[model samples]
Target: MSELNTGDSIEELKVTPDKYVPHRYAGATGDFNPIHIDPEFAKMVGLPGSILHGLYVMGLVAKTSAGAAGGDPRALKSLSVQFRGMSFPEQEITITGEVTGVEGDQVTVDVVAAQGDSQVIRNATAVLEIPPG
Candidate 1:
């Protein structure tokens, strides 16, 4: 890790949610919506198949920000995002973040998550508080 500065790029994080991720995530979050756990039901509702939970993707964004801040999750102060497209399981998802501003110890990072050409999460931003040296 290097000194945080404006325009610096955060290390990218790549994840591939397994086929059973929806089922496991549902059990942990109690979000057993068929659109996330039942592929047949999701298809019936016009979705290609069961989709990954939006919060799960947001978690990745947060992880990226925290990772850029010395891997301390508590360093993340705030996060926001817009869900742009559906993401399916067993596909590779790439998360990237860029430092857009640095004011004092607060850093603002712009984040994005994509699957192939589809932008699943866009306009995402995160604020991190880095302790002064």
Candidate 2:
């Protein structure tokens, strides 16, 4: 493994959920929220359309963080995020992250999810344990 220093930039991960992403996630997670699976219902509720699950987006952030830390998912110790906006299917979501701190084996990162110009996940943070090589 390469040396990791504070202020190191993490590689960005981008995701473009297909139209059936919500349905697939709903089936996998048992979160059948209409806002995430029903376009008409979402529109009726004043949304542009069916929105992606917040947890799904968070999962993307988590995976991205793990990848940044040498692709070991177990290295991720903690993750927190604030869902600030809705994400619709077929929209490109980019996960941006930076190493904010490094203490011993712990690496703290500031992460966010962006949909075009919109910041969908705000105040996102992830802590990972990078194994020494």
Candidate 3:
């Protein structure tokens, strides 16, 4: 793995959630909100269609940050995100991160996730604990 330094950009990650992803996520998270699993209900509620859970999009941010730390899940220390907009299924979500600070083995990253022209997550941050060589 390349050494992480301040101002360095992490590799971008992209994922396309299929239409059924919301349904499966709803079952796993027990968040069966109609807006997430029922397209008709979502439309009635003003959403374009069934939307992906906000937490799910946050998970993608965490995944991207962890990947920057050599793909080690344990390296992730903390994550915070602001849900900026709704994200729908079958659309590609792009996750990007940049190293904002590096102190010893701890690295802080600023992250963002977007779909098409809309940003699904913003003002996101992740701290990772990478071991010293």
Candidate 4:
């Protein structure tokens, strides 16, 4: 939320096990496909582990971006992200993005997350409106 110059990128977010994602959120979001929680079910489909819910991924990205932009997450205008790679539990993850500048009162961000050298998520973006004076 600092006065970012056009094209300025924000610092990346460090993720951990508790934040590994999905969890009960899948159930809360009604996306309870065992692959996101059950190991056996995940293995049945060849997943590494119960992966985080796609929307949860977006939430993390959006919240982090909002914090970076110095804006309230509740005031966001639009937010979206595309699934790229599967995020595994216990793996260290990082989320990063850039400010594509502002549009009127809105701020734009392009973001993604990675584990080690592997990209676990991609095509992330967040749009938020600046607080009115």
Candidate 5:
């Protein structure tokens, strides 16, 4: 892990297939929405496999991005993400973000998570209140 500057961009980290995140998450979140657990259900939704919850992916972005900011999660003021596409269990998704800009004690971030031609989550922005100097 490296330190995040007041105005610095972060490198992207690919969520590898070894992550194997969907089926287990379905069980954990109780999101037994067949499209998230059953292949048949996924096909019905035009998906290749069970998809991860939007919040789950958002959480990942939040934590990893926070690392880049060198701040605690409690320092977060607001964060939001849009579900642009579904993420299959074995698909590799990459999370990339940059420090974008900063103002006063607030830091603004621009982020995106994608796999291949499919952009899973987009317009992911986070506004955080950095700790006092």
Candidate 6:
């Protein structure tokens, strides 16, 4: 959004998922899956604990993309992210992106959201239209 060019890095976002994130998310989205809200159930099912919802993490990545695209949701053309690993609550996930291509009014950006050394979102890409100055 600010004189964007290929290889330019977007402002990174640091996200620390709260301990109550899963509970709040469940209350808000009506997705009360035990794997996301019931730690005991999750452990019984072989998960380390109640994991954050995948869509929640994806939405955060999208929000980061929107911020990079001039903070206007309309500038976004498309967004995609592959869920490569689980993201646990109370862990910090860093959202980072770099401009990959620019042609005409379209700009492509490669993005990743990682927790520690693990990638929670991979193959993340966003296409946006640069608003006329």
**Regions of model 1 farther than 4 Å from truth:** none
Give the distance in Å from residue 107's predicted Cα in candidate 5 to where it truly belongs: 0.6
> For candidate 6, which ten residues in a row score worst on lDDT?
61-70
Clashes of 6: 0
- Model 3 gets an lDDT of 0.92
Query: What are the TM-scores, per candidate, against the unseen true structure?
Result: 0.97, 0.96, 0.96, 0.82, 0.81, 0.95
> In model 3, where do residues sit more than 4 Å from their true spots?
none
lDDT of 6 at 118: 94
Position 10, candidate 3: lDDT: 95
Better of 3 and 6 by lDDT: 3
Of 1 and 5, which scores higher on TM-score? 1
Off by over 4 Å in 6: none
lDDT for model 6, please: 0.89
Score each candidate by Cα lDDT.
0.93, 0.91, 0.92, 0.72, 0.73, 0.89
61-105: candidate 6 lDDT, tens digit per residue = 888888887689898889988999998999998999999999988
Q: Write the per-residue lDDT of candidate 2 for residues 1-133, one digit (tens) a residue.
A: 5656788878899889999999999999999999998889999999998999999999999998998877897899999999998888998999989888999999999998999899999799999998788
Q: What is the lDDT of residue 96 in candidate 2?
A: 89
lDDT for each residue of candidate 4 in 11-106, tens digit (9 for 90 to 100): 778877563256668657878778777877888888866776666666677777877656465756777767777776667778888888776777
Local lDDT at 9 for model 6:
91
Candidate 5 residue-wise lDDT, 1-133, digit = tens: 3435555776667776433466677678877667666777878877866677777778778876776657477766788888888776667778888787777777787888888887788899887677556
lDDT of 1 at 83: 98
